[model samples]
Target: MRHSLPGGTLVLHPDELHDGEAGTEAGFRYRMIYVEPVVIQQILGGKPLPFIPTGLSTDPRLGLVLETFMQSIDAPLERLEEEDALFDLAQALDAVGNKRRGRRAYDYQAAERARDYIHASNGASITLDELEYVSGRDRWSLSRDFRALYGTSPYRYITLRRLDLARKMLLGGFNLVDAAMAAGFFDQSHMNRHFMRCYGLSPARWLSMLGRQTCTIVQE
Candidate 1:
């Protein structure tokens, strides 16, 4: 979707199939935060997620709420501060958004249980049957609830969690193959594909950027 999103325009639930391209020969630049859905659910307190339509938004409240969040991409936000900002963001989205109602009630507790299971089983191959058993919900409902509440399916969540471990391992100076195995991935290429999809960069490039960021922080 071609949108002339100004600096303060907010886009929500960006799960659609799309690609970014420069509109003009002069290249463009922008900043984005890839927050997980679980973070939003934590602050929303069992409320259904707000769906802000894709494209430009001129809502003043959203712009103000996003200012602090969008401005501090490079700097780290403390836990409390980040939580507050996310809360404001979710509230603003709800204020200007249409409610997305579904027939099935979203079982937040069940999804949370599944999420805990995923984290606990990090670096291991977990099956949907196991999640079903642990969460006490059927496979389809559990998967739907997971995506609605966490913004991803159980399998993807597992993959992302493993990728998180792989990222930490890599940052700690582990070799690529070793890190992949340690993170429960079958091989380096398999890990590389998921890493690129999640991070928009290869492991090597991500590591290089982290090194540069570290040097910049030290110099500052």
Candidate 2:
């Protein structure tokens, strides 16, 4: 289908059947961000997914949301900035949509306990069953709640926490292998895969950027 996506227009829930093509001979340039539904779920706090009746919206609030999130091609998002943006975007989305009720209530307390457990075990291998025990919820329910509240699966949450620790170690001049091991990854290669997926950069490249960022801070 031929359609125009102006600045600030969003196309959410694009399934496998959807594809895009340029309408003009000059072609189009755009950036696509792939967000896991769990991320939105966390921010929306179990509210049904917001339905934007038409795929296109010129709502200024959503425009601000998109602007806050989309970054330069090679830039890394600071943790706080990303979280704040998601919160605002979620609020805006929730306010615009009609309410729908879920069969089961969202369990914020259990999910929070699981999150705290993950934080405490950042450098250890944790299983779903283990989280189930700690959070006092069944394995399946805990898993679902965790993602609904935290924007990631329990396994992925652990990996991200490890990567955060590894980034700190690397910034402190530790070798990649040591950092990876200390952060609880099985090996450097294992860390490398997850790091790239999370940061859109290899460890070496991220380190290089970190160095430049540090230098800029020192100069300032």
State the TM-score for model 1: 0.50
**Candidate 1 ranges with C-alpha deviation above 4 Å:** 1-102, 212-220
lDDT tens digits, residues 1-220, model 2? 5366667465577473566777778888877666676767765655567777656566777776666567624454434335545555665676555455455666899888888987998668776666778888865566556667778666667778999999888888778888888998877767887799788988888877756322111112
User: Cα RMSD (Å) between model 2 and the true structure?
Assistant: 9.5
Shift in Å, residue 156, candidate 1: 1.2
Query: How accurate locally, in lDDT, is each candidate?
Result: 0.71, 0.69
- Number of the top candidate by lDDT? 1
Clashing pairs in 2: none
